[model samples]
Target: MRYHVLCGIVVSGLLFGSAHPAFAAGPVRLPSAATVSSGAAAAASVPQQLVKITDVTNIRQTPSLDAPVVKKAQPGQTYAIVETVAGPGGDWHKVVLGEDKTAYVASWVVETAENKPGKSSTGQEKPSTGGKQPEPSRTILNIIDVTNVRAEPDLESAVVAKAQPGQTYTATGTEGAWYKVSMANGKTAYIASWVVTATTLSGSAGQSAGQSAGGQVFIYHTHNRESWKNVAGSKSGSSVDDAKTNITLVGQELGRVLQQKGVPAITANDDIAGRLVLKNLSFTQSYSESRKTILEAKNTNPALSYLFDIHRDADVPRSQTTVTINGKAYARIMFVVGTGNPGYEDNAVFAETLKELLEKKYPGLSRGILVKSAHQGNGEYNQSLSPTSLLLEFGGVNNTLEENKRTAAAFADVFADYYASVQSKSK
Candidate 1:
């Protein structure tokens, strides 16, 4: 009767066939948060000895490997510090992370300041380089054939404007290859420098527009532990904390799927991890605080096309919560759109296109599209990055962890096909 409370699950013969595999059924009791430890949290609390090396895919370990086999550490994974080094080829220190766990990350990967954890570093930050430069100014230059103006420094954030060649503008500043230029209408805009050559430079740097690089794909995982924080099951006594652990697992599984599928995307790294930039946040933070966080981060990477904010949902009955795939229980993939941002229409079209494409290929795995009109916090969910931006909910908290993992694999394949189709047609 606990299953009777499900409001979101749809019963269909396709979910469970006669086979009824044993793996389809989950543990007698759902997992508790105390059972799973976060590497990011562990890493931040490490002693002043070790360093974090990579931007993403940082692996924590048990003992330590000269070159260890990475078991976990997807986006927000971290390590604890034990010792420190002086220079570039510094000595690697080691330490324990979680219960019965230990690992050694490179000396460079970690920030020295974190050793003194919880202390405010804001006042000690360096002064601005731009302030020392001459007055903020630009000369009107012809626009390239195609370019984009992003809300942040990265390609994954929302896009605010697009620039076409022949559109003249004054160059204000440059962040890497992206140039912030004054628009004809006096509003500031950004364009990828590679796409346009300065009219003043003229024939010196002439390059065909056809040779321009295609738009990039930016991927984000909004791992919210607090979204599930207080949510308790109607039938099952599973608390929001339990639900959050499963959601974290979903984020990991989804990342594994993308890597397995070789999808070109950028996920956050622990060293760069901040509530708004790289580290995971609560659902409340993502809908509100992270909005500004992503906006600023996207400014650094400007060549984005598709932006995906991964999530997990709850608040459904046990029966409706279970998702079965290939006669095996798996989580369902849900594509969500918030009807609040300026790009809602475009986002809807993009979601529809993706759904149509996937349904024709994979079918039922995609549990249709869910549009949260009034309840979604900011209503944008950062979908304004592109018409193709969307929030993807893997499955409800009630679903088994394995189900979510398998669903990630399924979605990866579907995504590869979608990218291929787009490439073929663009040709």
Candidate 2:
């Protein structure tokens, strides 16, 4: 009953949630990354494109933290800007990494080198820029305070609109100390530079990815292509390349549930079987293929405390693996612990704790914890990286996605209870 009420709050919050002002403009969002991945090809009339790094930062291949790190940006260095994107994480500046390659940097780590005023030590425009700088990009800016939007670029111009803080607008161009904004009523207005912060709106910036601040949980699939009857819409073999209907969806569900419980988490969808095939590794080496992603996720988000390798069991009998609760069918969950690593006991304790938690909520929901040695294959399972990692088998090949989601939700609730207990003790 309480869970459903929380669900209502979360869902409603999502529905009415206004984005945090992408810093001083109004509470507005620029074009999302999926909509603006590419920019107009036409070159600007002498565009000033330089991004100066203000802090040591990482350059990523893509805007998301899930993407690979392409390079590290040293502090106080300036790089040529290629493009700017509004991604899930926030505004990412795509800059030149090499001749043709590009990498993304967080906007917070860098400032626009082109934004330097033409004034010298004295307060007059330098003669070099002809006293009139070129226009700025169509980037977005957040309004941080109540600012006046004038009809003309000059402050003496009539006040056409008043822009409150926490709103975002596209900067069509710029004049000395002023940004141009196009109003919805077809009027062009100029907002003073002092009350706004230049930034691109993105979902990632100042936002937890899934769960909570500094608390990330990793969810992945070792045998990602493993599917079920109607639920299994991938390949006919043990592994499928499709992410839509394979074991990846179950991992996604687990992540979603964790997020709903205020646990920040991300689900990885790497090609486990494809990597194994390329390396000429046996099917049994599937765990090896998944190890790289596990390490990479941790490398990108060091705060990740819990790691789950979610998979479907190969039990042939549907009746044996399925549990009926509240007239709804769900897949039973099992935790497998590997005892070959230095942190093996910690992993076992995590699995046992989760199993006990789930069983307390819904009796027989968990199949109990299973301990495996080196003889059981990949017994280490990279559990050494984090003592809180677990191998979760959710139902068998005969189970459907519906059943899997139900169990995933219940598991999320149990995990939330455990998380609360841990948080209390830490305090």
Candidate 3:
């Protein structure tokens, strides 16, 4: 079977759930008319244009896919065009949703009406005023206590100010994962984007709190396209994969839950499978591909202390991979530690710690730890990259997304407790 072949050499088993934590949800309020009337009047001179969403896509806080999603837009939805901006993945249309509210949608996913398509008009729509056109203003709400405001975007830069929880600042621009804000002295300061929730003054509101800041933990997926049987479509096989709905969503949920618990985390959603196809590499080299992503994240944020490669187990019996606690169903979790690496023992201990924690908080949710040797599979599973790294199998392919997400929340709950305990001990 494809399942056995695809997942072979990776199974070394150890055994290791919670109520879903409440997530912050609501629409970001639109800016007052007085705050943006001047810019709106300037935009009036340009002919009104609109774009219809061609596919279901997220309207993000910023142009980047990594930016928090403000809301989901459906097909046939139309919005007034604001301006086009060049972003990370592709060109994006900044569309006005309300009198003073705007959000970004990928240009490729929307069809423009009464305008030339596929051509970027970034500078053409600027107000006729000799001065620069007004950029979207943003309010950064500090979610953590006592985060530093730096003179530059790098962490090594000198700290110029300090921000307290609930404090808000006006952001002028973004440089990487840092936000540049105007300080009281009329000079600008940089703040780590992960430490605060940002609401664009003219754009839609994002998560009111619990925004991802590159924290101590990094979550990613080596097999990002793995999907459940229900969502994977009519493909008749043990292995199911999808481009849009996949294990990456589980990683994202884990990151969000970690953030909500005050443990800052970043989740990587790189298409490793697609990369393999492009490079003409086989499935066995999945770890080799994901390692590049992990290295980039570690280089960008040296503070990353824990690395988790999330995945789903091959076709296993649904009964074996699920459990009910407090009347809610959740996918069971298993930790796989590779004994091929020199520091494999440390990874095993870390996995054990998490399993024990889960047993205490959400009993029967963890299947226990499994150890694999070099002969068993890849045997390394990239655990050598970090002593704290482990390959986490969230559930089997038969499990549902809702079950996997519940497992993520439960894991995040215990992980936050574990993180707090570790921090306390270090102090």
Q: Highest TM-score: which candidate?
A: 3
lDDT of 3 by residue, 1-427 (tens): 0122332222111000011122223323332211112122222223345556554556777665555667655444455555676654446667654323567765665676532112212213323335766554334333233467889877668887655333346567767656787765667788764344343332332322222232377888999999998898535555698888889999988977776566867677688999999999998999999988778656434556689999999888989899999999899999999989999999999999999999999999999998999898889988888898999999898999999999999999999999888777655
TM-score of 1: 0.47
Each model's TM-score?
0.47, 0.52, 0.56
Each candidate's lDDT (Cα)? Answer: 0.47, 0.63, 0.67
Tens digits of per-residue lDDT, candidate 1, 100-131, equal 24454433333332322222221132333465
Q: Which candidate would rank higher by lDDT, 2 or 3? A: 3
Indicate the residue-level lDDT of 323 in model 2.
86
TM-score: the better of candidates 2 and 3:
3
**C-alpha positional error of residue 383 in candidate 1 after TM-score superposition, expressed in Å:** 1.6
Model 3 whole-model lDDT (C-alpha atoms): 0.67
Ranking by TM-score: 3, 2, 1
Distance (Å) between predicted and true CA of 285, model 1?
5.4
Question: How high is the lDDT of residue 359 in model 3?
Answer: 97
RMSD to the hidden true structure, all candidates: 18.9, 18.3, 18.1
Please give the distance, in angstroms, between residue 325's alpha carbon in candidate 1 and its true position after superposition.
2.1
